[model samples]
Target: MTFVEELREHAELAGAPLPQLSDGRDRYGPVAAILFAQRSFASVRRRSNGTTLVTVWDHRGELAAWGQAPAVDDVVNTLRAWQDGVPLPELCSAVARYLQAGDPAAAIETLWSVLTDDGEPHLHAIVAAASADPTLRALRPWVSHGTLHLLHATDAVHGVRRGLAFHPTDEDAFKVHVYDGPIGPVQDVASAAATAAATAATW
Candidate 1:
């Protein structure tokens, strides 16, 4: 069975509706549904050029499954390389330096490689820089500011309490329920960005 067929079978087994497929030559093209849950499945389109694009709520559905997906190790290494012990301004400057060195795409690609890897301290810096930098503004829609803030806040609180385990601290306890879980902010930002970008794209 083709990849498309395999996707269909998986969906069917999961009790999802058979994805509506189309011929690219005449109609539109073979499209797949990504079952996010029992009641919701995202529409993903396969282009004639052999690209599988997953529609993100905001930006045109991203090219999720690239031909040569970078390995997890490569992503980890790239994230490690981007780490510079510095403030957000300095970090943004460093990223700008790389962008000015001739290849903005390479710079952005490196940032992406790091962000998608397991959560790292430097990932926060990268996100902050990318969110503010005009050169990297294209990445704004993808970065979850709310989620990042919550993660950092929670980690800080966890670290403090874990370090001072023998002694109970008011500050640590205060931060316990400071922010919502990872999903709340993530969905909020993604949903808002997706709506805005999709509307603009359609126009």
Candidate 2:
């Protein structure tokens, strides 16, 4: 079956029925629905080129992007990679550094491996939170907040705790947050990284 057809069929099976595209081009929403069906803590996004990306969080709680092509075979392959816990390409891993440095284009290209090199930490780490808690697994599409976040509910008082956070303020600037505690170390790191990168860029 074609990639679009397979997505439609799979989405039906999962009872998430996706909307039909008027021009029949592959869109992020439907693709996301298929990948996220019955599964949470992961998101699928549409690239400018119309390719679909499957996103998860790495061990460090950074966005780990995968699933570039979105062809029927590619979608199936990416899903299998996730299910089997395969590592992302080595080049894909560079996105974390790119993001930390406040480079969205570089990060996106890195995740897509546009230039090709190798990607992310173990895919398992990205999915672990959901795997351990059904409540988490039901969170769907994970709020983008401009960048991807790996979140889990810690305690009732604490609410949702994010391991990593990416905030895109604009095309020219963005922020990356990484932490040890619920929110302390991350705020400091994010502030420092943004200031440092911005300072360096001015020179």
Candidate 3:
């Protein structure tokens, strides 16, 4: 069966509502179900000027909801296509949002899996944005310090990791190894230090 069909079957088993063109119709529930069944879905809310607010999910049900709804289908469809291409990091990111909205613990777990899977650096980016639990922060040590450090730096550039730390406080106390990239550092230590400090303070 096609992915959409498989998703429909699962939605039926899960008793989720499906998607519909209009909200007033009884079939709307099924349409909602279909949208919810997959890790990603969009809610079209009509507004002034025939626009909509499209809420996209990241696994946790915590939607990175966006406005300007009428054009959302194109965005959502593009994302779905990316998932078919070996699990884009953004898919995991969306799923992370979904989990965070509903169950933070599950979101963290899902984010962790997404990170370790295929060693996708993008997972680090997603986890940085989606999770803020202290326990999850503790797990960062297991990640290569160099990689984490680099991510910490890049996170600064993108403002991704809001409240996480590169290393535990007492810099001298942590015996962490740094991973050197083949090229000259794309990120400077000062920037990374500032980013790490910010993360430590917020999350």
* Each prediction's TM-score versus the true structure: 0.20, 0.32, 0.24
Number of the top candidate by lDDT?
2
Displacement of the residue 9 alpha carbon in candidate 1, Å: 54
lDDT of 3 by residue, 69-151 (tens): 23434334433433344243454355322212334344334334434432334334423432344433433222333234323
lDDT tens digits by residue: candidate 1, 99-153: 1222334433433443443233433433443334343333312223223221221
Q: State each candidate's clash count.
A: 4, 9, 31
Off by over 4 Å in 3: 1-101, 119-194
The candidate that wins on TM-score is 2
lDDT: the better of candidates 1 and 3:
3
Candidate 2 deviant stretches above 4 angstroms: 1-31, 34-42, 47-49, 65-67, 87-203
Angstrom error at residue 181, model 2: 19
RMSD of 3: 15.6
Which ten-residue region of model 1 has the weakest summed lDDT?
162-171
- lDDT value, residue 133 of candidate 3: 41
Model 1: what TM-score? 0.20
